[model samples]
Target: MSKSGITVNDLLKFSFISDPQVSPDGNWVVFVKRTIHKQKDYQSSLYVMNIQTRELIPFTQGDNRDTSPRWSPDGKTILFTSNRSGTNQIWKISFHGGEAQQVTFFKNGASQPVWSPDGRSILCTTSLKENQSIEETESDAKASKEQEKEPEPYITTRLKYKANGQGLLEEKFSQLVFIDLETGEKTQLTEGSYHHNNAAFSPDGKRVAFSANRSEDPDFTMISDIYELDLNSKILTKLTNSEGMYTAPNYSHDGKKLSILGHNMEYKGATLTRVWTLDLHSKELICLTGDWDTEVNDVAINDLATGAGSPGAVWTANDDGLYVLASERGNTHLYHIGLDQRITTVAGGKRQIYAFGLDQHRRQAVIGVSDPQIPCDLYHVSLDSRKETRLTEANQHWLLDKQVSLPDEINFTARDGLSLQGWLMKPVDFEEGKKYPLIVEIHGGPHMMYSNSFMHEFQVFAEKGYGVLFMNPRGSHGYGQEFVDAVRGDYGGKDYEDIMDAVDYVVEKFNWVDHERLGVTGGSYGGFMTNWIVGHTHRFKAAATQRSISNWFSFYGVSDIGYFFTEWELKTDKLDEPDKLWKHSPIRYVNEVETPLLIIHGEEDHRCPIEQGEQMYVALKHQHKPVKFVRFPESDHELSRSGKPKLRIDRLNEMAEWFEEYL
Candidate 1:
């Protein structure tokens, strides 16, 4: 029998549950199940489970990967997208079992399918029409050159944020499409130069909702507003057109109101993305929770049978109420939010409540939770009985008596008196007196936070007998907006001091931490900090930076959203404010560096592209500093999570090995 212990390997193989859907009658639930196969070096698949029997079934499988599973309104079939057909295309399978059939035959791929209310059509978003590759005719070009002595006008594509994963900006545009279940005819609902993604059909089937940045803000990368489309006229109208990004829209069962995930631009970093409700007729928007800093992982817009307009909107099935995975006291937990807006804790500890969706009856829920030792697993959490039962036994057998250490959550004050949050882990068979090498792991985002979730990379450092320290320094979300925004324009100042203070605190408090053998590693913004730390101080013996930004001047135009995000964070838009962006750039202080560095980057990363890593590697080599570079091909900004799974594993292994060899 497999022991109920978490291991570093388990973190490396952790899976996720996303785009959860409940059947029409709420009797069955279907979701995507991801598993990382080290042998194959990939993660893939979709799964279904009966709410009543808890009998798990794998719906689609093969060499082709499948995901984003949604049940048809009548609940007799499952609609999903698969790469099994060479490219991602719509495919369906009977819930009763047997072979899955391909649905849409369009050359372009489709994803994120939603079933229309009457079950006559399926609503989804696709770049098929928008992605037409055009070749300039040689004859037309020759004629134009002879006639006007001017170059032929090739197709000029104008779109928002297309340079990332999907290379080459073709004439293609992302739009909403409706497919007839019987006739198989496809109707383009909304069309234009604007990109439409992550759409959902209204409960009444009269409208489809989506997120887009149609307004003429060349810097509109951050403004993703919610829009609703009229099915009859095929006209699109804006719903929530605020300054911030509005996403994850879900229609209430009654069709009178809509629930959506909203991120206000006023603040960034580890802040909360709240769940807001808007009345369709009145257009009155109401903020659902005051706990704004806490993340609302997934919300179900349920119209309860017992209470209709009870303010909090309680949905009870199997005697349980609405539950949300809320972060509190440094950890995420399942909580019951009552119709009266009263909150009660269900489960709390050092764990992550990644995702959850209601079952058919609305009584019990299929919950996905994970900790340091366990990868995510689905469970049935009863509302009335307060009982949680494990559902799928996916990779439970892989963990056999592997020992892992639980993190010691610690709070320390920076030199400037700002409080910082961190987690430390010692060796599994830790020795009290012997000083162990320490590794400081920094999280990216500068706006993102370092939560107490199961992280494989950090665990590996611990397993290799290195004391690990990771913290939410200035600018990390999870705290209030002011705290998160504190790091802006002050990058290497207080934030750097804060990290140095953390090392000071750990060294003083923990007698087992080796002061001489210190190392640092981080990705993206965290990677920037890692590079910055080594350049400014030689305290760390070694360092590894991933997908980092070495120079702000080049990053502004080279990265996808760097032009906007860099300006926003640095409070400067152009070279006129060169001093501001430069003061915070890591390359500015490379002359002070003494520690050896390893640079890892994704070749196609648009967020903080490969150039950032190249600049650092070139500078270090010129400075005669010991350095190395590892570039992953065919990867984007999400190399850690969505890059080639095997490559991600190797990336982590390489970082660990670098520190082990140098530190």
Candidate 2:
């Protein structure tokens, strides 16, 4: 059995599984296994498992992380992106397992390889522009050789003001590259001064579909036009010209129509990614799904190759317009899409739906699922019979005696009578009517959702004898578009009240919560909220704000995704609306803070810079408040999940210690 209460070492050894890729034949699945290394920071590798035999094998093993595995047309080869070659590049290997071969060689890097339908080529995106190199000039060198040459302007100009992961003004562009499988030659497809991504090949091998924000929409970074490429003529044609962003294009097996995901102004800040199909001949666009709230996570069309009893996804040669897609209906699940665009629930529940595959007959499908107890396992499901067959015993034995807590869904009404939803995990050894210290766990994204799935942090709190409360307040994503937009321009208003009411509800009704000895913590936007909460109210005795945003002014320029996100959430552009930004800033209300705040931040976090924490620490110390700052050297914004193993463990230990001392 695992040790009780999270330890520094336990945090270091934790690993995560993501990006599960199922092969076309429905025989194997490959996925990325991420592990944190205390010394080096992050480590990951690719692993493969046979669906029929239930045999698992490690594909690539090294110090560097390998991810984004894509299967070739014949299913005999696998292509993945890796940093083993000193930079991220496409690497290929046979399904039989042997020495992996590097596919692309460039000065910068390339990733996300997708195969062409004919198996003759592959498509990958590369951001090749490098930062200008400053050559050191020596005084002793020949001065005459450098004479009479006019200096070129070093200034770079681009209309794009904000980016998702890279904040501030972005002047660079990413282009698509097509690589020949047989000759090993490569050709750059799209060029000029705009970013293009998410390329998909047409089923007939004649054209390719991609999303791009070209010279058409220079200022609006969110407006992406779908383009179709005639592979033979090297000509590009516009498919959908709109004022919103469109991505993840997929071609029907017959190549007569195209389906893509799009988000317009009506979606607000969240992605109401609905499936839209375009007719190639008529140039008419058809909106298939009416519900904009139901986001289509991943999509695939049914083909003749689907297995028996499978949902007959329109992927193979079968003329049936069937497809299998995944969506977040409470939890992630695979759904069967009929010819008329009707959706039927395929497989999903409290446990996560990682990935799925269907054989030729479309009668059965293979699913990858996991929970708090089971890491991830492959299961065979008959779409017709609805029978599930467990194929892998990967974590069966290890989870046999695991002492994990089942979180109970709890709801409470805020002061404004708005219904707030959340989950609470009692101690693993829960006692009846026992008053225990509480830990209010907050989620980041301010836009991201905290689902019913198993979380390591919640388990750690349960083992530490603290009642963990995590909720989906007004700003969470999965609760529809209106709820997500509620926090926009109104930070700390209703959202804070909802959280406060949640704590009050638990304290008043549970009788087990020691209201006076409560602690609060969260990261990213959640960290921002934590800082905001401790400043506005001192209901909790202690607080741990990890990767928090204490100041909105600095955050607008410092964070990678802040340039637009800041304006989007605060409802104002920087320099243009200073007062509005100040009104939403937590630092503005720091004068009312009484609770002890322990700040945990990463040294190299580009999302929320370290200075945010430093300034908060300085302000608190200057005011003579009980505050402490802990910095993890050389870690990014994902420090809690992907930081250095040892440092992450240290972070959790420090947080627990802070609450242990004050709460």
Candidate 3:
């Protein structure tokens, strides 16, 4: 390895691997590999690997993004979604290697392909016009092409009219459709004005289970229930009637039970997701991990690469158990849950398992893992022996000559007797008795945890001779439901204390930390906290907040999820207690700010809209406070994680320069 430190340019050299799916016979594994080209854009392609010999070969080639690969039931063919035909659609390719055949021809495109258990049909999701048939949609397209086009005005009717990345509402809903393999005929399985998500076929192939909000007031309520659609009768049965969000339903091997991940919303957005089993015969629901403290999904957020989506609760062959991923403390690990309600760790350590595919018969799995020093790679992990064999080294050459910083795990107690967990990364080239500037980094999703994964932003800060400290405060996942729920209705209360306590512990324990030259920065919820910290106390010399929320009063009506999110998180009825919403807003305390602050926001961000950053900037500017606002064009709430490659680098450089000038 070279003695030089890592730089922003080094990010393009790393490759990201995700969505590993093993063939039925356990002989081969197919996965998606993504790479950044000339720091312009990301290109993803599918690849296959031999289990025994560890030979890797590319299955799909080209610049088009190909992802979400799934093995056919017979193991003779592989199916995936690709945009090679100009738009994303399902395509099928033989396992022996050949040209992929297009399956769907929808104008809106298709995604999330799931094959039937008998391999006769494939189910996918595609957006369709509300209350309009496929023929009508095609007719409208033809007419629009023939006539001279004019700018159309947007007429708003729905409560939620715009999404962050999807732009303005189009009166379309995502519905399920199935394609017959033999006849190549397409049929719409479900239709509605509401959205359907996480659709899957039952083992018997007689019914389909999916989650949707079929209520009359779906725009006002955030409730979704699991439903089963009978193929022959065209009857939809509600399997769950809870008040919370329920989704990602998968049938057991025997088809007698269903496993799902959800919460009752008792704690609102901070509620921990648990695995529940439903008896199809008796209609009895039981939470399998009711007593478990960890959150039952992947919450390891990082900025290095795009993450492969999770396929919840992979069932075993005999239906006696299932494998699921859980986030605990600072790591996401695979766990096996038995029918008797016992939980056991299958493959786990101080590492993040981003994605995995299980072969129950062979007792082996193909998993995507990464750590502080490793970007990400695939490995063959044996469930019984707990032995992990490296299968791919996509980043070895780029990382070989780079000096990366590894985090030191930390544990400390909050003033309220709460145990908080975090990590500290020292400067890359450390010298004895040398004091370095400390930067306290906070994670978004007050519910998301800062886990043991590769973080490009943190490493960049460390390389610039700064000590980076990040932690899971009171509202973060991986902890129990109570701990995760503690931050709700108390936004800047205990959550703020937990972060400040973390900074205090680091400053007292580490002798090389310059307490006078401290910096604080975070995005989303963390951004709100950064604003809160500087407003409440001027402990840090400089602060940078990204995609933040300043005033909850205006946010309730303007944001996409504002109406419910403000009520649920702030624990106040916007109609009844408007003052409570303003009480927790950072803009309420802006006059107390004395530190040099930097505000970064995405112009198209709907989660925390640009108006939020604007409100704060205008207030600070009017008060003659030292603050500057930077706006990124065509970016959303995910700018730091999956925005354009060039913009992401510019964002990092901007933050570093702000701290370099102020701190």
Of candidate 2, the 10-residue stretch with the lowest lDDT total is: 300-309
On TM-score, the leading prediction is: 3
Clashes of 3: 0
Sequence-dependent TM-score of model 2: 0.87
Against the hidden reference, what TM-scores do the models get?
0.87, 0.87, 0.97
Runs of candidate 3 with Cα error greater than 4 angstroms are 135-148, 360-362
State the C-alpha lDDT per candidate: 0.70, 0.72, 0.88
Which RMSD values do the candidates have, in order? 6.7, 6.4, 1.8
Badly placed stretches (over 4 Å) of model 2 are: 1-8, 36-42, 130-172, 216-220, 298-330, 339-341, 357-364, 368-370, 392-401, 574-576
lDDT of each residue in 1-663, candidate 2, tens digit only = 553543345444445555556677777778777666545566778888886787889898988878888778778898999988777888999988789998877545687688888778999987644341112112212353448778664453443443323444435568888989899778888777677887888877778888888755556466788899998999899888766777767677778877666667564566555667778899887766655456555311110001111121234345434454444423556765544767777786665565666654466676766554555556788778888888665544544556777777787788887777877878777789778899998888776666655566777778878889888788776556677789888888888888888998888888878888899999988899999999888788999998989888988876766677788888886689899888888988888899999999887788888899998899999999999989887677777765556676688789878888987
> Using lDDT as the measure, which candidate wins?
3
Per-residue lDDT of model 3, residues 1-663, tens digit only: 437778877777778888999888888899999888667888899999998898899999999899999998999889999988777888999998789999876777789999999998999988888766543333355556779889889998789999888878798888899788999888898887988889988888999999999888898778889999999899988988858788889998788888888988878788888888888888888888887887999898788654777788878778887789999988999899987889999888898888889863738898888888778888898877988888988888877877888999999999988888999999889888999999999999889888899998998898899999999998888888888888888999999999999999999999999999999999999999999999999889999999998989888887888888887788885797988888899999999999899999999999999999999999999999999999999899989978888888889999999999988
Model 2 steric clash total:
34
How does residue 292 of candidate 3 score in lDDT?
83
